[model samples]
Target: MNCFRIDESGYTGFDLLNADQRFQGASAIAISDEDADRLIKQHFPKLQAPELKYRALSRREANHPRLIGLMRDLLSDFRCVTYVCDKRFMLTLMFVDYAVEPFYYERGFDFYAGGQNYAMASMLHMAGPTLLGKPQFEALMAAFQRSMKEKSEEALRDLVAAARATNWMELPEVLGPLAKYAAPECLEAISTPDLTTDVALIVLQSLITRMEVMSEGRYRVAHDQSKNLQTYTEFLQRFIDHDANVEFRATEITSLKFPLKLTAVEQVDSKDSPAVQLADVMIGAAIEAANNLAGLRSGGLDAEQVLSLYADDQFIHMVPSIDFEEQKRFRQGSQSGELIDYLAGNVFGPKKR
Candidate 1:
């Protein structure tokens, strides 16, 4: 079985609405164990820095010929799959009205009129059952209603303060039910950009897809150690077991399956694993490319150009194509366009040639 190493960059925990977090992505690098050992021994010693990271290389050796040469060599040596999400566009497209508004309407509250009160109501309604339990959620709703009637933000603030005083896990329960209510498509859309679950799904899918075509669908996957490793592994196992389907917008629906066999999934330290370090470098490059696309940076190697140098389709696959026109519309502040129409035109349409 072939072996692949995975790593991520540009994760901002789970704050989907944070404007500062413009990008989120992950990368998987496929190589045989012998090739991995050989490549690291051959290339790592030539680097001036002890570690292989995109940010450090960009900052300290942006103009270094050796660094550029090393990057080129790494790209040529491994098969990489990367997925990047534009967090700002994703949030605006998925959450604001379609999710938040309908959630409030279901509870007989006018989301627009209540402003912050409405926001608090939506949060409590979504998170209540899961995090606060049904009883506490209902009580919080009662408090919020009282505040809304009296035109005060105090009750909502108090609840939020209490939630903050507890664990961070207690705070983001809003994501789950909100995603469920949004249903089949909305859940996928919302989760697609998530730092944890959705990102892992796509990365694994990409790896499986590439392996099916290139390596007879057989591989052992290794990843850099992460707090979410178990969760990610469970998700992958479930997808394979149940034949889960992944829909890209509406353009394509694919069964998340491997044609051959997956031998193992394991985690390794990047400090000790050259394969994981290479995955890190690949993700770093992807992050830089995403930043350039978002206008956060300028004048560097475009990610597409680097992928082209490898001369293989499986070398790099960017989830949600950077060329997607709806992304352009969202970036241009035209989010008021009908969601269905947008999906039909951009996502559900036949793949562009």
Candidate 2:
């Protein structure tokens, strides 16, 4: 049976709006225990730690070069994939679902029918602050987060207050289709918003899709996030028992039968599993690479090596779309556009001839 070591990074529990770590995700790598050991030994011959941690190694000047060498080796592997999501973008999407989509849904229509969700998600992500003011926009997100946790009267009041504070006439571009739902009663529809399991399932689903093709549907997930994802055992257990269908709704419908090739999901300790440690480096590199693209890490970043080493489709980049017009209006596309183009180029590594 094939074994894929999986690990998640940048998770802040159910709170999606974490300030420090904006990216949360998981990576899956298919490798034997022996290969993982051999690679680690080759790179860190005088290793002293029980586990090879990417974050720790990147911090030390002497070890940074070795870390990059190890990452390049890992990237050379044929089978690996990383799925990352922006927490704020996820929350912004939820707001559109709760406050905006329902109005269209009531009229026997799909809110996301015409790439509308992408447009709205991008618009709200960028224009929301301009339309509602940053404070109110944040309050509304907090309200959405709280409302989904449980029925909180405080969350409801905050939602109402945020809606009441919005002057629809100011930003008609966003408020045009959204104005109908700008009222407090319409916003009250945000009673359920579960983002916790949402991300985990996406990570798992994407991992399963790629693993199915790579392993011929015969593999078990060796997960290493027992603390933050303790509840995931049951969800993964479904695959072990029967052929489960995993589906994701986005631009299109993605559905597949699982356990056809998958056996079980074992929650392994990272300290013992070199495979999981390798997965750690892969996922951490993905996050750090994104940070580099966003200019989050202004200082030296050995992790930037991931940009060149990454396979075109290996790393998934899911960042929020900034209000492009607003950016152009302020900087005349001098700063933001240049950064955006640079990021795009790095994301896929110069086009093939």
Candidate 3:
């Protein structure tokens, strides 16, 4: 563990790594008094009392292979590699409040590269200095760490609000712009699907997630001329396909005097023409069917029967715009086996023996 302390000179020690070895330099890294205190709590999780105090303060500009490595670990745990890899971007993000430099523009390339990072950083910028006040930032960012974390829904709602109010205000523009390039038949195919309000809402929500991620991804590539933005454009296209067309079969619980089977087409986008309307109706119909089944399973529509409402959908949609392989690789590397299994639950549900 590399320990950094604040010296009388207002600087700490930094070990910057060069190609073959290492050289010591004055600490260019800055640490606030509050940051030092939090650092202690992080390392000594069990230390509860004044017994563990910031007796001294030090700053190490080291990539603190250990500390930075742990940060990478926690970030991976939260799927944050997209943020850390681009230190320059984060630095700009940190300074966003001090100034809105030309660096803040969201180029098309940034839409694909480190998209999540860009979303987060943009979120922080939009959410403002309140976000800089440690507790607030941690609370807000904690949502990105786990799929099922507490308050994540609330955090996401906040994100939705922020996204809608800011750069994402023109999401509908994507539909119009892309419509220009795609084949008329393909565009028609994309546009003609029918969807209901409920399904449309879900589709909109999913697109928001995708776009936020894309923003970060594009930003990463945009910042680096060496990086190509086309990959992100391809990513967007694939994500759209996977999210709208990827399909699997599931036995939906239904409730008619005579049971009926519903064919659910996965990956329906709401902003697309009629298809979104159709998907919404199907979802609604499915819910109605599930409710009927539950009511029958439990005598006389007891409240407890509603517990089944929590059951996972057998076949849900993935965005075709994303690269499923890339997403899968991301999930496999960052999450635990159980978390991965939980995600797959939507695919397999309770398999019939």
Go through the candidates in order and give each one's C-alpha lDDT.
Answer: 0.49, 0.64, 0.25
Q: Model 3, range 1-353, lDDT digits (tens) per residue?
A: 11111111101111111112111111101122244345434654554443321111112223123333333222222211110011222322322211121122222322222233233344443443342444443432232222112224453344333323333223322212222222222122212222101111222222223223323222111110112222223332333333322222111221111011111112212232221222222232222233344342222222232222222322222211234344434333232222212322322232110
Which parts of model 2 are misplaced by more than 4 Å?
A: 170-189, 193-198, 239-255, 258-260, 298-304, 322-353
Minimal lDDT window, size 10, model 1: 247-256
lDDT of 2 by residue, 1-353 (tens): 77888888887766788788777888888887789999999999998998988888767778767877887787786478888888788777766655665566566655544445555777778778887788877776776677656646775666655555666556554444334344443344554323222455545655665676677646778877568656456556654565434332222222344334877788888888898899888887778766667666643345456667778556665556555444234323122222222322432133110
- TM-scores across all candidates? 0.54, 0.79, 0.16
- Error of model 1, residue 71, in angstroms: 4.0
Write one digit per residue (lDDT tens) for candidate 1, span 1-353.
67777777666543433456567777677765556556655655556655566566556544434445656776666666666666533332234333344454456654333133224433443444567655554443333233223333463344344333333256453433333232233222222221222244444555565554555555777877777555456655544443323222211322223223666677777677767777776677667776776688765566565554454453443323333344333334222223233322433332111
Candidate 2 TM-score versus the reference: 0.79
Listing every candidate in turn, what is its Cα RMSD in Å to the true structure after a full C-alpha superposition? 12.8, 9.7, 26.6
**Can you give the lDDT of residue 61 in candidate 2?**
75
Comparing 1 with 3 on lDDT, the higher-scoring candidate is 1
Flag clash pairs in model 1.
none
True-structure lDDT of candidate 3: 0.25
C-alpha lDDT of residue 115 in model 3: 31
